[model samples]
Target: ETLVLTYDVIANDGDTDSNTQTVTITITGTNDGPVASGSYEHQIVDGPGADTYDDITGQLRASDPDHEVDELTWTLPDGQGQYGTLTVNPDGSYTYEVDEAAVNGLTDGDNPVDSFTVVVTDPSGASDTRTINISLSGTNDTAEVSGVDEGEVIEAGGGDPGVPTTEGTLLAVDADNPDNRFQPDSGRGSNGYGNFVVDEDGNWSYTLDNDNPEVDALNEGDTLTDTFVVRTEDGTEAQVTITIRGTNDPAVIDGDDSGTVVEAGANGPGEPVAEGTLSSGDVDNPDNVFQLEMGEGDSGYGNFVVDESGNWSYTLDNDNPEVAALNDGDTLTDTFVVRTEDGTETQVTITIRGANDPAVIGGDDTGLVVEDDAENTVGGTLTASDVDNPDNLFEPASGVSNGGYGSFVVDANGNWTYTLDNNNIAVDALYEGETLVDSFVISTADGTSRVVEITILGRDEPEVLHPVHIHRHDSGGDLWVPEVEGFDTGSSRPSGSFDRSLDFVANWLRESSEHEGVVARLWAALKPRDRLVYTSDPFTFNLQAGTFLHTDPGASLVLEATLKSGAPLPGWLYFDRETGEFSGIPPEGYEGEVHIRVVAKDSDGREAQVQFTIKVVDEQEVGMLLEETPQDDTSNEQTLRGKAGFSAQVAAEAGGNDLQAGARALVASLQALEN
Candidate 1:
């Protein structure tokens, strides 16, 4: 309201004095209310998707003519009608968005109220309101593809290579509208995966389009992978991945069918048999090689060799007993199966025939046997056999030569035990590689005289090397070398302690190599006593918060700890009856400290063990060091609690409180107290 007024007065005194003025009044009418404009109905999708910053304009503007400079306050309609927080700017521009929580509860086509009101009030208490008619709807959502049970496998050139066929179908729902359907986002074969496509009905199929770049590159065993997106009429999408596994061709093994060799014994009268090499090759894979199949021909004892690097050859193992017992003019065919890296196999036949008539000894004459106190048996059972008759008498020629050779015993009852003549020869003289051959006269048991030559091989003590690292140090803080008392005369000390240690190690290794067959025996004797000793501190790990690999191909493995006598297991995880390995995989959404106990016990009731920890979270996302017991069943698991045990069970199960956050808060409190 506008108004104005005026008044005048006059007076005289002694006569008196006074003044007079005119008075006027004009009133400004009561303030006019605000006016509303720019009002209209609008349609929008129901979600923010990934655009967190994008917003919807409310489009409501207002002004008051009576109080142009007075600020107007916008009052938005309340209740579920407002999707999200409505914010108004000073210039009267306001925004709104569909809240996920609100949208999640609303179904397609379900409308409660048809319109809402927006009120604008002026500073003078005058106000005006407008009706905003609203319409509710929903969008087609992404399809559910994980539940589709189907996979693709093809042998590049096999299985309808150029034809499109159904692999499986996809299923999806609009969530907001169950009747909404999903179809290919792109037309026909335009999905970038050759002709792989999804129809409106979610039928998935693919064809080998030779013109396509990826299809053109396909080989015998090359696996190819691709993905496609499908959508509903309302622009929603889902992705599917398809895999094509590749296979390789079989390997080709080529070699001569026959070979010739001179007649010779392996250790005595006959030696070196004829041999040949079989070459194998593979066409596709670069690391292709050969593998031998067992129980084929003479391969029962590995009569053939197939190296991982593709080398193939035949082996004549005279020491196999069967090969060594062959008589002159005897022949045998050894058949073996050889295969390529891809399991393609072929059978190879090899004929081994002796060209002379005679009994011969084969194989390395030298042999090894753990010392049985001061005596040991040596030599082979195949000494001699007559060609003309099955019955024959073989005995020591009434004359004794080389002493030990005649000391052996052979009887028709098969008593072919050969005892070393340690009594006749000094222990030092009966050394490794020592040769002793005694002649035996054979007479025909049936009186039939026949002549045949045979071979027999024997060996002497030989050196087999095995080395272990060691450092030398004496009680006097000095290094002891090779001549340290029992080792030498305790006089082989080096210029420096380190050098002395090096010399001692060298000497020890030399002795070890000379010990021949005794190294393993000694190591076996000393192993059990030290296995009970703890080699390191208890194994430990700090697991991160989040779900870990529980058979999910892409999920990260948080821990793979293995216990050992000394095996480095930081990079491997395996627990079986033999190894004392134990590891914990935290269930999905379960994060907390997990304490573990690993125990190892020997047959004598002696036990050794260690205790360790796994910090489920890298940092203090949790306020407390709450222990989370592993739940073997995902369906039976329970939510976390603010306190341990049963303290906060009811509050957690109430389903209204943030139990995870509450537990974190408790941890924070305890941490604060400690600090």
Candidate 2:
């Protein structure tokens, strides 16, 4: 710096004359302080290894107008600035190097300024100071993330957990940022295998989508790795690797679960009813085997069997009611469960088909009835059973007669009835004690048939007689007896000489009775004197006249009998005179009528006599006689067939000599017949 001073000394000379002698004073120029001016600016990037701003050499200038540039000195008040260091020369040229550490320590922003003061001085000690500004422009520092990058997640066990995941913490730092917290929007990333997410605090998780086919196909003990990148807001990324471990999978089943077979060869101890094969699949265990909870299994209607190879069979139990009752075209079902060693199960079903079984007809096939019984019908119940069909029906021929002997009827319920035609010629032709079996075919709906027999026994219809009552007085007198007093009018009788004797006896009875009523009554009581008998059968009779004769109450009476012609009884005839019971068997050669007369007497000398006849005939003659007689006359009666050769001894003590002799003679006759 230079200075010039001018002083007017005329005042000091103090006089006009002194003004003529004016003083001239001159001062020499001296060096002055330099003026420091001008501003310095440079860009400083923040971070390690950043470049320094050295262009301030001419940017900060100071000059000395009164002093030489060499005499002027430029000095920095402090070499160290808040963000860098400064250096200067006498010419005011300076260099500034921004501290890398100081720039890094500066609060992060778009661009910041660091200013420091520098001074320039001359030899006179005058100085000037200027501010040096350094603009700090930050360089983006690489954001770093650090943490455990590996994670492990196990595959879902049987699909229980749908997603497998693992979590870890990631730490991030950015030297150029005031806030190091991650931004969720840019902090998460995913790859083909899984997704990864990170929070502001750098907590991260990797989740595997197990539903993916690639992941699901994994086998036990097999592993997979999923890589995902967790990034910071500045685009810095870190990898999180997730390892997926697999577990055992359940077994699967295939093939048909149902089958069918015939029951014929599949029942009892026979072969299996149905057969099937099963298949299982397990990627984790390729050699999986089937498991049976028990050695043998029951399928409700049958037995079930299965092997480790998944071969299964069902056997029907013959004793099971449902299986046994199966009919042709009928079906029965049996269900059972088959399992795998891994506890997988499938339901197996078996259907059994049926075959026809013959229907059985049971119960009484033989029936019995007597021809002479009030109802001469023979019948019995029938039973039928079928294993296949519960309801049984008789054939259409039921309720119809196949033979003339009887009509046989059957119902759907297996009940049957056989009615004998007693009046049929074939039935009537049956001899006494003979049996005729009426057989007919009975059948089931299936065309199975059996013969049913009805036994019809022939029985003789013995003659039933209505006796005639004759009242007698106590007085002793001659009494006349009707010839056939107690004979049944329903009986068949022979004609001829026997009729003549009956007429004679009727006249005698009419002479004694006298009254018209008595005559009519005697006529009704009179049986024909002739009787017909089969030569094959023996015959017997009683006089039946004592009922019509009258005698004294205290008198002893005896009966005397002979042929109507006063002939003795036939050789075949045996008589008990006291009681007048006659029994005889006619010889085959003798087939004719024999006349008989019976007389009764008492101690009072009263006597009565009646005559009757018996005729013997062969079977053919008897048939002819039956035909000649009216059906109504013979329908209700049959000829008496008696056991032959019965005799009785009598002691006679009658009042009259003739009666006593007759009694003795009758006794002798009976005794001789006995021999």
Candidate 3:
């Protein structure tokens, strides 16, 4: 079929279809797309302001409902001076940085604004753009003011609001503020606001007349409720609670009196008052028991009770008899027994008293008498009297004799006499000028007695008589002989004896030269025993001679006699061989007594004679005898007689010259008897 169909469509109005009778009809739909009314939303977030140290990175989000975006780019606004550089990221984010010079340029006065754009391209080549504004503000940072209030109000019954509004008793504040601004007369000042009064120290005060109306009028224990507050000058406030307590009133009792008393026994005159009457002014008070502080002797004796109307009587009963019998100077006391209404008793005591007696004597007086032969007389006598009984008499009752006298005899009148001896010798004679001590007891009818002593003066001269003797001869030699050989020698032979008188011869012979030879011999015999031995080696002698004789020859003989005893007697005798006589003087030193015995033998060997007691004189007399007599002459008989006479005279004058006559007689007798 290859049949082509051509048709000419007639125009709606008179179009000529004559030109074209062949009609060709072709309908083609091409892909030219309908564009949707695109809704694109783009948001631009400004980067942190482009100052130094600021966060400058910002993100931009653009959304298209109909197309996709192919790229995101950011552009800085054209008029932005070199404040910073802007960079766009693929994710629709941008970063802007201010250079050091730009940062320096943004000083206190040179603040600038920065604007930038972010462009987003869709897949269809459709583009969207958003703009962001970044502004730089000044860099001055400061702390904000805190705890401030503009104004405050307190309710009427709200108490102290405890807020730091105006300075008052309910509010205290700190003076220092953050701004350091203070105004004393202004509400914002530390001590300003309301009726507050400030002291010199800058502390604040106020009148809480409404909230704490009773604060000034309240007592210590009164109760109250209030709030307290503290505030700072900057208007900072702090609150505290305050409560008022109740006060106690002073106590009261009836009468207004403080003290009361009670009687010892009853409850009236000295009765104690009630306990509450003397109140310390306290409620529910305890009872005050009554007490008697001071008693008779101490403080506790008087009566005390609890009842004010009780009666009491005090009867002292100290139990001290001395106090009961007190005198004018006496002090007395008694204990008080207090009885209560309940019949209970307590005791208090008292005391003091005394007595005395007069003085009296306890001892007696005594006396003493002088001794019989004491040198002093008039010894003292003692008198005695009793202190208690002075009128009593003293009399002697016993006695002793003094000076060897008899007991004393007292006369009726109390005078005494002392008889010394029974033989009528006076007391004076016995005393011998000494004190005659007589002790005697003198007694009175009242039985009182005293001892007395007496002393007497004695006769001055002693009573002694010389012995009597009768003289019968003128020659004298009398002595006493001892029984022992070495004892005293017998007296010399006297011329005669006298009847009752002394011959006086012995005394005369002691002074006579005629006895010189005898005296010398006696002295030698009386020599001490140690001197008796004779020493013949040197022929030393101590001798005295009674006579010298002249013989018919021209030479003379010397007889030296000695008295001796004990042993080898004749052997001890030394005689000169040529002279037919003994020689050698006796030793010079002799003492005490010498004794000897002699025996003479006759030519026929019959014993002839014995003699005793020869006397010897001292050396002085012997020398006198030798010097006074002449050497013997043997030439003629007359010469011999003359020499013998001369020797007799020398013997008589040896002691002295008085015995010369006796010596002459002895010589004549020797001459006449020679036939």
Candidate 4:
């Protein structure tokens, strides 16, 4: 069992021997940890004071070979709350918020300083630390006062003290050391000085009174002077001067030294008196003397004042009614004249108005008569006579007719009578009882004239009677029956029948009436037995569907009539039996075929006859074709041909046949026939 393994030993060492062996060895590797670099320290000084705490911020970077190390953490070994709060971020950044209470704990002195330490730790538990210093220093807290002058003074009534005075005390101080103090030096007090006080805010105050001895003693052309001194707590001072002067004013009036007086021979009851002047005198000024005062009266007395040179004048009172009424014939007695203290005179005038008497004249009545029998005669002449003048004549020499009598004439004596030619007659009636009134003037010896009216009564030949008639017809060409009729018939008549006839015609011719646009022919005719009166000649005849008759003008008559298409016919005609003349109007509704016959009598009883025929047609149908055509050149040269007849043919020819070829040929044929 004790066999030991051995190798054969070779002499030359080609072979190796086997033996038991024991060995010892060692192995080592590199270590990698966070290495902090670029770490620096900084400090922040407390504002203007001793410092007990320091606050700072800085960058800390660290690196490690091992992947497990991600960031470094910052710390303060003395703890945060003791000095202030320290904040560390994962990016290896750090901040220090120094405690204000800690900062105040430092002594209040110049160049006060404080210190602190900051530590930073890495993830590997490695840490680094640095120290920072903070310093505080004291500064000035006072202001300097300046710009104030010394030994200046201002008057008692000077303006604001803040402004520079003519004489004033200036104040100043050193502002840098926090204490404000001033003292008076060169300009302490002079003329303008009184008492001044300085406020804590560095403002100075000074007051002046009007009742001050210096101000009260200032009279016209006098001046007052004073000085003021302004000082601060620091002994700085300024000065200003004040001045006051007086002004002159005009003397005031204390009492009335002027009076007024009435002018001599210018004062009277109910009479116009000239105004008296006022007088006044100044004590020392001659030019101011004799100042005039205003007067009180109906006169314009205020204008009687003297000028600056002491000259004066008086004004009269013309407003008095009694004085205004005075004329050359009257005179004022015992009138009193007054004067002002300065002495001025005026005169009054008095007069009486004249009397007047009127003259008179008289007249008498005169008479005259006609050649006819006195008992049968209706009137005679009446004349007027003036006792003052026989040749006095009358105006309006002709007298008007009264009660249907003829006109009369007035003679130079105011006599009026009817003409002989118009006197009593047989066949021609005359006015039996008539009168005429006229006016005449009678002259007097004084060349004045008086007017009188004279009325004359007389009779002239009776008026002859004239006759009128009206009639109508129906549209059927038959006589029209009258709804109302007149009966008078005579030889002579008023010639205004046409005027009355037109009134009747207008009634039926209205746009809304049945006879609108109907053909109406007016006719006037005379019979062989009826004589034509020269004055009664017919001027115009108006036909309507009515009948009228009269012995004179203005009589209304209605005719009996019928209408066939709104036109009156012949049945409405009427004849006056005595004059043997006819007149009538057609019916309002007459139309279609119409036949009219009329017989008229003139003023001389002469009659005439007339007859007419008419056919009624529609106005719209007649002109319709004219409105619708184009009327171009080609159409204008073409003649129209159709059953519509000549009217259409003329229209087509005027249109020049511009219609279609067929229409043109037809129109040409029609035009040939028409031509």
TM of each candidate vs. truth: 0.29, 0.41, 0.20, 0.21
The sequence of per-residue lDDT tens digits that candidate 3 reaches over residues 155-252 is 22212233223332222222122332222431212322233433322244333333233432333344444443344343434443333342322223
- The 10 consecutive residues of candidate 3 with the worst lDDT sum are 520-529
Better of 2 and 3 by TM-score: 2
Order of quality (TM-score): 2, 1, 4, 3
Q: What tens digits encode model 1's per-residue C-alpha lDDT throughout 1-675?
A: 577765554544545565555667676677788887677465544442321224556556787887663387667655235545455444555665556544433544544333556777888777777665545454333333333534564533322353334366666544443434655543334335445656676676655344444554455657666566566544566655556554454456676534433233522344333344555554454434655433335444225555555444565554445554455567556666666656666666665654333332222223333222244554333333434224234332222211123234444422243454332222212333333232222222322221111112233344332233222224332222211111112232332322211212111222333422212100000011111111222332233222121111122222222322122333222243333334434344444433332333323222222334444443234342333432122463333321122121111121222221111111111111000
Predict model 3's lDDT versus the native: 0.32
lDDT of 2 at 673: 9
Tens-digit lDDT track of model 2 for 132-239: 777876665656667778898776656467347788887776655533467673332344666777787778777777666667667667887777666666666677
lDDT (C-alpha, whole model) for all candidates: 0.40, 0.58, 0.32, 0.34
lDDT of 2: 0.58
- Residue 316 error, candidate 4, Å: 27
lDDT score, candidate 4, position 637: 40
Worst 10 residues of 2 by lDDT: 666-675
**Winning candidate number (lDDT):** 2
lDDT score, candidate 4: 0.34
Candidate 2 residue 587 Cα shift, in angstroms, is: 64
C-alpha lDDT of candidate 1 relative to the true structure:
0.40
Please identify model 1 stretches exceeding 4 Å from their true place.
1-180, 184-235, 242-250, 257-277, 287-331, 336-347, 353-675
Give the residue spans of candidate 3 off by over 4 A: 1-70, 74-225, 229-237, 242-257, 260-675
Structure candidate 2, residue pairs in collision: 1-32, 1-66, 1-67, 2-66
- Candidate 2 ranges beyond 4 A from true positions: 1-161, 164-171, 178-192, 195-214, 219-223, 243-252, 261-272, 287-289, 293-299, 322-332, 352-362, 365-377, 383-407, 418-675
